[model samples]
Target: MDWNDRFAASGPGEPGPPSVLVGREDLVPTTGRALDVACGRGTVAVWLAQRGLVVDALDAAPAGLALGRAAADAAAVTVHWIEADLDEGLPVTGGYDVVVCQRFRDPALYPALAGVLAPGGLLVVTVLSVVGDAGGRFRAEPGELRGAFADLDVLVDEEGGGEAHLVARLD
Candidate 1:
């Protein structure tokens, strides 16, 4: 995915935080380094920065990165926006205190996501699901989130309303 193309195509004021992540403060770390995979306009990334975590926000879109940089600057926090093709996999070099992957589904990257968490780090993810909607290849099935993150200390695992969310802490 060319992030620049997507950003160029966007017609909006600014992107807001993903709805699924709202009211989920417990799933985020209050300090330490964080990573936002496939960070599209950076709403979540900026939110994390506001929460006091230094963030490395990755996206394929240049325009989105620009928005994220602006948001970080306005928030008086630092966020490193890296333009990356998620298809090549997450470019996360250092383990993070918190890792957030929202609205981007890739079963192949599941293990990689789990691998990048520090021992006590948090992993919060939301992906399209087939729970209440017609089944599709990209949608997660019932128990997918729990089954995938079974080793973690799961705080919440909800699969319904066409979405699956998992908030877990690495042990």
Candidate 2:
């Protein structure tokens, strides 16, 4: 099913905050621009806004973006919500102090993701992985994120329980 249909079926509910950012709060800058790619329901984007960052949240599903807009409004934070398909490549370019892509895997976008970061910017990413689980078409193989983001100074890299997480900073 398409994302719009999937989100429509799921109905209304916040997805809560990003656990990756929660665990590594110290790594996140209090001010500057941030982008949350494939930002469903805007949890991470709103959270970043609350932390004093100007945030841009992108998602292809209108239903999801609507839910995200409501969530952002409820939180009394402002987020620029962009509806764009990542398969077409990143809609915006460069100068983000933080870029987050959680639970979304598109290896093709890795270079663009890295390119958007300002110097010393933080990147937080998490995705389904083959580690400790059966491999699937959507899952990343072991060390996939590390290999893809090797140019960054990786601070955290952990994989298990069918998921992989990475927090890195660009030089």
Candidate 3:
């Protein structure tokens, strides 16, 4: 999917915030650096900023980053927005206290995702799943999230109803 186009097509939603990766707050650090991968419109990034974490958010879409910047300004928080394609892989520096990737699936980047975490950092991810629906290429198979992030201490893991969510802490 071309996230850039999707974001370009979206009009800004209500000024209020929404979390792309719902729940899993207990796993997130109250204060520290955070990263939001595929951060369309910067909802999660701005939210983390409001939670007092310095944030670095990345997406291939410039339009999305622009909206994210507006949201961060409205929230009176600062977030660094990077425009880049994830297919090239996650940016190589700056470890994060929290890393979030929601509703964007690219299994090829799983290892890089895990490596981006700082020690004791939290990883929250959600993706389309095939557990409760007919299988498809984009839908994660049952246990896929668990296996992909097996190195972490999975705080919450769920797969069903064509969705998968995982919250884990890096060792």
TM-score against native, each model: 0.88, 0.94, 0.89
Instruction: Return model 3's CA RMSD, one decimal.
Output: 2.3
What clash count does candidate 2 reach? 0
Highest-TM-score candidate: 2
Query: Which ranges in model 2 have alpha carbons more than 4 Å from their true place?
Result: 12-16
Q: By TM-score, highest first, what's the ranking?
A: 2, 3, 1
Q: Number of the top candidate by lDDT?
A: 2
Task: Please estimate how well model 1 matches the true structure, expressed as its whole-model Cα lDDT.
Answer: 0.83
Q: What are the lDDT figures for the candidates, one per model?
A: 0.83, 0.90, 0.82
Off by over 4 Å in 1: 1-21
lDDT of 3 by residue, 19-111 (tens): 423443555667989898988888888888888898899988888898888888887889999988899998857478988898889999998
TM-score of 1: 0.88
lDDT of 2 at 17: 51
Segments in model 3 whose C-alpha atoms lie over 4 Å from true places: 1-5, 13-24
**lDDT score at residue 106, model 3, on the 0-100 scale:** 97
Following a full C-alpha superposition, what root-mean-square deviation does model 2 have from the true structure?
A: 1.4
